[model samples]
Target: MPDNDSIDPTEVARPSSSRRDPEWLRARLDDWLPTVTGSPATITRLEIPSANGMSSETIVLDAAWEDTDHRLVVRVAPTPDSDPVFPTYDLDRQFRLIEHVASTTDVPLPTLYWSEPDPRPLGAPFFLMGRVDGVIPPDVMPYTFGSWLTEVSDDDRRTVAGTTIETLAMIHSAPVPEELLDLPGPGETPLRAHVRRLREFYAWASQGRAGSPLIERGFSWVDEHLPVESDPVLTWGDARIGNIIYQDLSPVAILDWEMAAHGPRELDVAWLIFLHRFFQDLAEMAGLPGLPEFLRRDDVADAYARSSGHEPRDLDFYITYAALIHAVVMYRIQSRAIHFGQAEEPVDTDDMILHRATLEAMLAGAYWAGVR
Candidate 1:
């Protein structure tokens, strides 16, 4: 960690204007590793994935210090050179939430070792967690297109899906300690609070470009359809089997807390369902199989009910809200690709966002008219 007096969490930290040159990146890591290990540390292996995560920078490494070896993963806030995916990056909050959840409940998570807010160590605030060996579904090729899950039998698929739901149930059962981490304010339900933050995020992401009318429509529809009540519990914001690390067909570590928050249990439930749908939709567009039958909505809902003893409710509202949030995220991500010179400008701003028809049908009530 950098010296506490040198950095403030609120003051923005930016990386170099261009991606750090190879030599600079290597030298910085060489200098930073020793400070982390309490002695001179030698890197045995290091990898920073090339895939776009739209959240934080993930660094996976193996190192040796003082005759002790360790495998660690560090998640760092983006530098200015690497424009961030969100309006804010609070590594401290994420670290505390994981610690609290790991100690308070049975939810599986990577064992967190250190959280250093001082950016001097690596030019950005970050936390290090022990890396458990497991196979994570790949986002680059996309697990839905072809992966271990596709090769497995339906029985194995059901077992994995059910275990993931049970894990979510355990996470939702965790106690909410507002003092340790941020929570929704008075009079606002968790879902509404989340929506408010997302609106602010859209505003930030929309600057210097023609904003999407679809996003605006989504915001309006979501505001009018707020649920009557929502249970405030820990929500795994990016809940999906893809985020889980599996070994021997069981989740060894539940990863990704950048979107973690206190919200209705239904928020995570809806996300787990809708994220898969988003990918399934992508596969359909390409004319490929995408796990259409596995992780069925009814099966997920039933599994949650049996495990948690509280039936999920108002999924129509929550799932649509999840899609709305995801669409806005897609717009921002497209803008990012433009900034980094990956994709050509689209004819219409809405073209940047995926699943437009699904979002429209959701608002018309046709998407879940009979189900919800």
Candidate 2:
């Protein structure tokens, strides 16, 4: 979840663009579904979720097809006028990536239905998948603040963490298709290439706005401490508990693959760890204990090793890199907010990053000393 330091959690964060009309979408679906399924389809209900993501727009729709009801999710690209977070929205790539992972691995994934590359139907490219019924950790108040995850026993939380790691291991073990390789050119290491991409994204995001000094320093620190390259694998780019759908304390399906890429296993592992820490730190800041013991760095590393037979190495660098990546994302989100008039431009652009202090601590090599 991107940190919104000033925005109230009770207020849902969405782009300032005009809301998509549910009735218009229902009419479009009514026309489009029959062409894809080869059967007449009637959309009974079409709703824009209240908690739609700041990036892609998720549509929850119920329809009658072949005399049976179907509940499905449609992930539509942000309209060009919405000032999308990422520069590009490749729905086709995301759709194929999910399809590939579902076919090649046992990683829990939603049942995929079809991909619509044409933008005419929804005003943007989108893909359809069966909606899995489960509880997702809320990003608004944050599960760490208080949610089902917090109410569960420590043992249940442990089960959630352990099983989630196993699912990540399964994803990493999937065969990397040739199309997924967007690897570095001849002279670059995968880690370096990854950092380079981050730099590029930051450059694009910071244009026409104040740049964050903390983010610049983070890039310098990464350049100074880049680790020896690890073998790249299929990495679930946004690997975190918040992106998962859980049933009875177990992950039933993994959601959100826009960031899926070819990267080191540590990229995924450290991201999972650092994201929890991000939320935990927020919880503690609010005088809440949070799940301090959940998703501990060392515990996650050990569990990944046990599950994958490959020891995670250089996590300090990787974890810091993870924080830096998240900082850049948060910065971009805040920039969008400012553009949409939801936030003011802070005197110090670093203020855009809610975890600026955390990133600084990581860069100073003092963050881990304070953690167990």
What CA RMSD would you report for each candidate?
8.2, 2.2
lDDT string for model 1 (137-167, tens) is: 7664667788888888889888888889999
| Most accurate candidate by lDDT | 2
What TM-score, over all chains together, does every model reach? 0.90, 0.96
Task: Kindly give the number of clashing pairs for every candidate.
Answer: 2, 0
Instruction: Write down the lDDT that model 2 would get.
Output: 0.87
lDDT of 2 at 267: 98
Tell me model 1's lDDT, rounded to 2 decimals. 0.77
Total clashing pairs in model 1: 2
Give the Cα RMSD of candidate 1.
8.2
> What is the C-alpha local distance difference test score of each model?
0.77, 0.87
lDDT per residue for candidate 2 within 1-372, as digits (tens), equals 223355344333665564688889888888999998799888888889866257888899888889999899999988778888888879888889999999999999999999999999989999999999989887778789999999999999999999899988999999986585568768987778888889999999999878999999999999999888679998889999989999987789999998887789999999999989988877776767889999999999999999999999999999999999999998998888888787778899998887777898999998987764
**Against the true structure, whose TM-score is highest?**
2
